[model samples]
Target: MARRKGNNRKKTFGARDDRNNGEWTEIKKDNEKWETYYKAQKFIPEKDWDFFKKTCQTQLPLTFRITGNRKHANEILDIFKTKHLPQLGNVEFEGEIIKPPVNLPWYPDNLAWQLDVSKTVIRKNEQFSKTQRFLVLETSAGNISRQEAVSMIPPLLLDVEPHHKVLDTCAAPGSKTAQLIESLHSTSDEPTGFVIANDADARRSHMLVHQLKRLNSPNLLVVNHDAQFFPRIQIENNGKKSFVLFDRILCDVPCSGDGTMRKNINVWKDWNTQGGLGLHTVQYNILTRGLKLLKKGGRLVYSTCSLNPVENEAVVAQALRQWGDKIKLVDCSDRLPGLIREKGVSDWLVYDRNMDLKTKENRGDIKESCFPPTKEEAENFHLDRCIRVYQHFQNTGGFFIAVFEKNGETQKDAVVDEPPKEEPNSAIVKKMKTDSGDVVVTKKEKLPRDANEEPFIFIPSVHPELEKCWKFYGVDDKFDKNNCLVRNATGDPTRVVYTVSKSLKNIIESNEDRMKFIYAGVKLFVAQRSDIECPWRVQSESIPIMKHHMNSARVVECTEDALKVLLTHAFPTFDDFKDESLVSKLKELKTGCIFVSIKRNDPLKEDLFLPVWNGSKCANLMVAKDDTHELLYRIFGIETTRNEQKKPQQQDEKKEEGKMTENKI
Candidate 1:
């Protein structure tokens, strides 16, 4: 399991600390240069400077967002709000008062929440054990996310709809990318749009896949590519091809990350004025590229985890100047009503690495764009629309966000390629070209060397294997059969069959020769070995996507109490349920995998859908052990699964591998 991030927040990278005589030593959070630089810019009031620095030095609170498939997330939230929140009243931990987690008012539907408590206390204290178990179980089940409170803002503000094509410019360790996907599936189980999560690092692209795959979103595609030179994609429409422009784009570019000082100790030690100044050009490049990829009237949000004006406002100023009146900053002063944030500074002083003010006369290596905007330029651009979140405000990490919308067409679009391409040998790509522009392909860049994903080949929709499964499950014409896909060269359903969204299917089919698509699709079917009518079984992860497409008569309803019995035992007989109706339904059906919708008597009154392996006389819950434990504890106040799949060599030992990575939320 991923480590539970402490109350304050978590970072993916950290330096090893030194220990003296087994005692931990804390690093000094004081930085003279950091204080001097911010004081010069005066982003906050002078009276609040001391408080801001103090807040940065202190530890952050534990924050998390309830997430997952929409129906499942709502069910978890209902259990938390109605069952857990009211029990922990007037609790005190150590010298401080530990309050129940409260909802972030700016967040929609009370989905985001935070509380002041450390991770150690949560693990060891009896007062928090109930809530801790709930968090751990749901987080493991891919329902709850322990992300920072402020980290959830940009995706929410992007306001993704079910039909908008979205792009996450630098998505890795994909917390925000998951949020955008949940929004896409919010209105309907089958959404029309898709998300392209692009990260430059090949290994980090795999990280993106790991984080997002659990959501089972067929609309999301993770790719390894430089954000500065992201590939151009064209969709075949009306027997012709056109470049696919995004409806919403997010540019959460890399920055100095000084805004995360409260949670990251290294930020306080390594921060310098040059940190932001050096990153200004790249930040500007990414945001501009994102804008170019956006459709006219589309919205793009540019943001960073830094407070430096050079990194925040300076980057926004340059993009505004280059785009002219074609794009403008969105006025969000009234948005996020409960959020406490300051307006973007219209003007600021620029300093060099040596702490000398860089004026036009003595500006040595300082880029002209790094300097403050002229008086008239500021008025025309309305830089004040940008948001500046301070550390002291609401006791959260500092952040800066600027929303922009494209208003008109541009004269030209940039298409970056090298020279020419060699003949295609692999399924990666032959050459990247669209209707709007020609692609530049070099000899060495013929195929993606890092991606090892098998080719996505479509099988015959009316094949014998599919016909058996569809008929057995009562799958009708509501779901498209042509979208059935297999990841082999022969266009055959060998082991697992997949399904992708219509939008994603088009991209993969059109650009399979050149695009580096790492992973996409939900596991629609898996080859099964049982004496059942169907040769393939529906995957548990795909139940939410398939619930509406399958017949209601095929679904088996069970009481919540009976669900606990199946989760705790390995293979319980039908008579173990002690319910005549449930036993009759099990006897009447063919023995194979089937969907079991549990009828709950909780405040939410939502039916929980799960997959079960039904045999001639016995049945078992088809979920992982972590998942089984979650249902047991959440519903029946029981923890621990009675049946664990045994690994003979290490039967006594628990699961532990050295490959654990930290959460970077």
Candidate 2:
């Protein structure tokens, strides 16, 4: 299981030690850096430090095993240490190392200390797989945050068979995706299943990619598009399209993120009544969409990180309202006995009959629950189906989840794809033709060979407002081409086709200018833009573009010289011209290369230094070079036996290979 340290009011588990303590040591090697951070407050006196130090030693790797019968607790603990402990030398209890079990049955034939427990965890004597174990310890910023939402997923889902198709809607910064991969052992086994992780915002899908790389999960296909409008894609591989309907889907929708209060005080500080309401609609939309793709008897889990009633119960209640008896809310309260011990409030504002707190809270600042209901009455409604796990319960982060099954027939009509809209060639033509005055152009001659020779168009520099629109729309396709093609529509040259091309060129150059931005920092959203004139404008046509482009646009790091080669050779496939006419045009134009600038001091990177109350670390580090690796080892208190530092060029390559690449940083 991921380990935990002690807690302090000032030192919330997720608090950044480096940010909180500025004199924090900064150790830089290659492209990566390392620094120490401390959470937990200074509440303990000097004398208590001795005791706390002892606790830290013993509690460092504490795995909280909640047993069905208290009598088995001691026996289980004894067996764990005696039989299993010796073989798993890397595993620890608190901080001290123990020997392998001398007195146990069914010992390792080839055991690897994996922690794959049965679904009935509390009831049996569980064995730890060679893989690491995990627990839902507590909910607070110091322990976990919104970005790590998927970490709360039960490892039991990993029990899924090979070849199964899994869907993770609202999957970004995919911690759960990583977990599923680890369980499936994607690297060694040729599993039959594939994981389709989708999010509404195209940009945020970058998180899933980053985590996938770090977690080294290859069975996943990342899609940067709206999950609600997911294409019913057919995968005809070896002999057939292995999957049509998904066996499992996780709808971890967006919410106010109340569970993140411990890490992000800003949310709680700015909390408003409408906070939950604003996100509930989108959450409902994504969930309903997933339900459509589920096969008969398929299981789906709807979950959220927010504690607010509007986001949690209200959305689920609305879902039940919309589907009638087509779906049944299965009881998942029994899944985590460690978590269920905590009480959850079922008398949410939605159930209030007379003094409806929801209405009162929104209409005005109402203090009391106008429509009060008895505890027994609330219990009868199975409000308990909505699990409310808090941080205090297990020193883990807070999160809520409910499982359901599709019981009856799905929509009889072949699930129809959203109708296609007509293409608007006029708009596309106008945008390329309009003249953009005073547009910034790069004068760097003999530019990096890998850089695109195509006349660059930087969108942000050409028009600040257009750049603002980029964030809203995400990619180049989202622009209103109809407006672009109608040169006279805007009268302004800068808003025309010529200007649009210039804008595109400028964006390419700027990306080159900001070389550091080559890698995505954090994905905030995902979106797509379509051609106005393509005949294949159906959902199928759109899916390929979104999938291929999403994969292609991703930044891959190589040696500086190699990157320069790739950048200088970039070109554009301007849709303005047909392929017959475009053949000669391609030879004359050059490929485009843009530099992405990353902040010198990125907040997300800084956030990693925050103390992890209960955290997991991969032993074989992905570092840039031997020196950088040495530096990290030193911080972790590992002694270095050699002193040979590699050359800068070699170090750079190693750094590219070995460092921890964050989703946002």
Candidate 3:
């Protein structure tokens, strides 16, 4: 191959194929940008020619175009032509030409989504036909292959059918988010459930959205906000509709990413002890914030790609100290048994003097602690609940996971939180007679499933070919059946029945217009009152009780049978409603239902987030004229404006500089 010159983009070239001997050479004209070659040769590969051609072109063109000038490009081409053409055949560059592998790793044994084309030219290969088909296969413990990870999801997810609200904090390039979505959809069908995926950085947020879009999951919502400030997004789970308190939250916080060192050599360069420590505060804040977002008895899983103590154990310890009994550490050894589990207590690295003393006494080893002895030793000790996934297990990169359970009554019977305050027209009257002959109002526990023990019928539409799969279960409807209970006309629109409790029956009849439920049966109905203005909410304390009790009872069709059983049960505490209302008010305040108007001046003005009152003097935060102040107030609702504050000395200097005559006048 010889180098040609001129305007590469404007050059008009045509291929000259050889019928007998395949070879290709550039066709050049004197006036054109490129040089011409005589008698180009065609290259042939040992493998199937069609497959080889497709493989070369599918993921190569983007990297090849605009590589460099004609000479440089030809030089690169000559290398590939001489090296690969003889065996692979002269692959055409006209339509989607695949670039030749350059100086890259040739590790064919390791299976990945990409091919080992070159050191820097990693690419997605199109050779495998089962690229998108999901399958399930069992492998040795902790030795699951990539193909297995990709295929084993559907069945397990169907079994896990996670219906509760889930949050993926630090989600970017959302691989796990996609998995979560798939699991949610495959699980028992439930209407009105949602997943919130959030990321802090603006650029990565776009990537998160992009990855999620490919999954086509209707349940996911992407949010762009700092995890530390997520509490500001008020969620209402009013009795009528529950606001989202995450049932499951994944805090995959940012860390030093030591596990990624093989791909990102940059991580190993200039890595320091302080680098991991620097992220400790942010990681801790994110986990704590996630804890707040959890409903009572909700589960949270915190993971990191770093192996350092400051970034892992230290952060978890900080959370445990602050939350204490409110959050309990959950062992996840069963989920990842193949990977070695560094006993959380044994492997936990304590940096502070107080904690190090305990670790040393317990382990009788000083050198192994991540925080060995240093001037900062006193600062790093108190952490206890962090686990490390080491490279010692299954040749995989380091990963740390900690599952926390938010249980017990506000940390106290450890009873649940109160329910929302009743609306003026709510049927939950101040007082009502219980079946036990007490005039105690407010339902305590959840009502029974239905009026009778008839199994609740659900019809789900299946693919025509899969119709046989539904016959055994007696599925009458398809997607048309209500997967979730709703309070609507007749209360059994979806054919699901509900059973009302003795105390609740009066409330239900009192506000029949506002009452709603999923009558899975006569004695049981998923009851909710819709008259409330806010979203439905559930208190943290009530979550455990709800999960435990709900898990035991099976759904029934008749409402009467459910009521018979529910009437015998005591209502939940009066506090559940009180807690619900308190949380509802908090949500209202957070969602900005009450608007705060601000003034703005320059159109380009940034940092206008302050919420201030109308006509009030703005906070003296900026330097501007009355017009600017008014504009600030109008634009941001900040209480203070530039007009209310004196100009700073730096502004005075700039003003003086502006006044100086350009020409010596």
Candidate 4:
């Protein structure tokens, strides 16, 4: 495709997609300004420039990760290795070898995987359907996350602990946010630390709720706010109100996205210096606010998908120059061991939209901070500590990551950090940039507040419904009664009773009126028939939590075959189960909710806990239809039980995934 001449916002371009016999559209693979701008920086080796561009034009491989609890992730991994990998190995269709999915070496424990095939081939070919079904179902079940390979890097380096309060300033379409939540619950059923996933867009923040819903994390709280001016939240500290600071913060700010050209091909036509230059101030401000809200000695990562120096190194240089050594780029070269990356460029030139070197005369909207730092300034900053992931290095998208530690890690209890002294909702004083490029501390202006959130009403511990579930489900003293709450204006638990982490409970109770609460908690119970003694049914998402609380009396032993029949048939008669003892146990139980414990096996691997509804003569599987379909296919080698004719496969696949939460890990 040739560049269009004249008048495209002062210029024009040609990336005409010419087609022949429905063959791949031949999009021109080159852009002049994009090439010239990066060539001047010399970030890549001269010998690899052509190779880098070549790789950028190529399609990005499909990548995903097995998500949820550590042990659950292992179970999924075992199935993938034993079942999927062998079948996918060197698969062929019409004389072409479909490369098998490979484990991402740098990602821990081979949980992350990459497949080198086009979406067209995967969806259209009959040979890959089983694998595709497996991916689709598990993804629907929330046991798997189909995330980009490079997109998984920042959270890994964040090194979040179960007790650290973490924040994602720009979380949206939240794959990375999902990883952070998994890390928080890695070893414990209930993590002390909670996650705050905030996006500037209101709609995107709600969309985040859907993506993160798979994890069923009671610890996550989604909020919609401009990241650059995210409000300072207050939490009850020793019975006194105080501002809360985060221990781990991710600043994956908005960028030019040129590095995504391998998949987002429009960058070929849209690439320009203005894109990198235009968003610099906003990006810098977001990072600065993230730092301000980070606890001392806490970790905060600043990253962008673009490889532009103005957006990457120049921003880092400016921050380092402002804070001096107070905040330093953390050396992460030893982490993510197999990850290929380059050192941050210490020197680079800026450019204007006209493809000319940006200077005082023509650098409109370009901040002075966009300029390369002096040699002395660069030396002090030690900019080499930043990590740059190139497209050619590991067949991944371009990324720039700079991890920072404020002052140095504040020590807490194997517990959480005590935030520095600050006032709640009291005009947060932070750094800002003047139009002329001078830095000054100023009181932030009032941001738009939200009054639309439903109240999170905690149910009383001694309520009749609570007492009934306590007796019937065997919920013990170990479970905190205060964690159970409902969302509505009337403060009534008319339907679902959800569970939240103690940390989130604190934030919500302290700041409910001031903050925007999009979604939180795992479904502990849903309204059931009043005819039963226990008027609440256990949610599949809450099984992990309920597992520890329920005693042996509430469990019924089941096998893979029994589970298969129960899942596929929806409701199976008591006599349908082969085990006489299982039937006797169900017969003994009240006609309400029950637990079926699948003992450790070769295929299922670990003990699996499932919720069920016991009737007088039959037992109904509590799992959702989509989740049931996934289990049948992935565990029993059976395709969907419901006929494909009933609904279009695309429509079926596109509907919301089952209620699998990240807690499966």
For model 1, how does the per-residue alpha-carbon lDDT over 1-665 read when each residue is reduced to its tens digit?
Answer: 12333545643333223223434445678889888888988776799888888898898998888875555678788888877788766677776667677888988778888877777777666757768877877888888888887888889789999999999999988988998998998887788999999998878988888889888888888877678766777689779987788999999999999989988888877888889889888888888888888888899999999988888888899988888989989998878779988889878988898888888667899998988789999999898999888888887998999999999865374344522433566332223333434443222222444446576666556666787778789897888877778877455677889988878877877765566777888889988763457767888768878887888455888887678677766666676787789889888887677778886666554578888776666666778777877877667766553344312222112122111101000
Best by TM-score: 1
Ordered by TM-score, highest first, the candidates read 1, 4, 2, 3
* Sort order, lDDT high to low: 4, 1, 2, 3
What's model 1's lDDT at 536? Answer: 78
TM-score of model 2 vs. true structure:
0.43
Q: Assess the local accuracy of residue 636 in candidate 2 as a C-alpha lDDT between 0 and 100.
A: 28
TM-score of candidate 3 versus the correct structure, residues matched by position:
0.38
Candidate 1 structure, TM-score to reference: 0.87
lDDT of 3 by residue, 1-665 (tens): 22232433442234333432546554321211000000010112234334422332221211111111233224323433453334322223325444332221111111122212332222232211111111001011101122212122111221224465677787776766665655565433232455667787756876776556533343565655677666323322334422245677888888877544433444434344445656778888788888877778777877787666556665676676666577777654455333344644323334332222335556443223233333343234322344554433323345666677787434321222332323443233234233334342332222232353122222112222123212321333432222222243222223222222222232333322221221211211111222222112221112211222321111111122222121221221112223444224333332111111122233333212211110111111111133233332323333332125322323333343331111100
lDDT (Cα atoms) of all candidates against the true structure: 0.78, 0.39, 0.38, 0.79
Q: Cα deviation in Å at residue 247, candidate 2?
A: 0.8
Best by lDDT: 4
RMSD for all candidates, in order, please. 7.7, 20.0, 28.5, 9.8
Error of 2 at 305 (Å): 1.0
Cα-based lDDT at residue 76, candidate 4: 80
User: What's the count of clashing pairs in each model shown?
Assistant: 8, 108, 124, 14
What candidate 4 gets wrong by more than 4 Å, as runs, is 1-29, 359-365, 408-453, 602-604, 641-665
lDDT of 1 at 445: 23
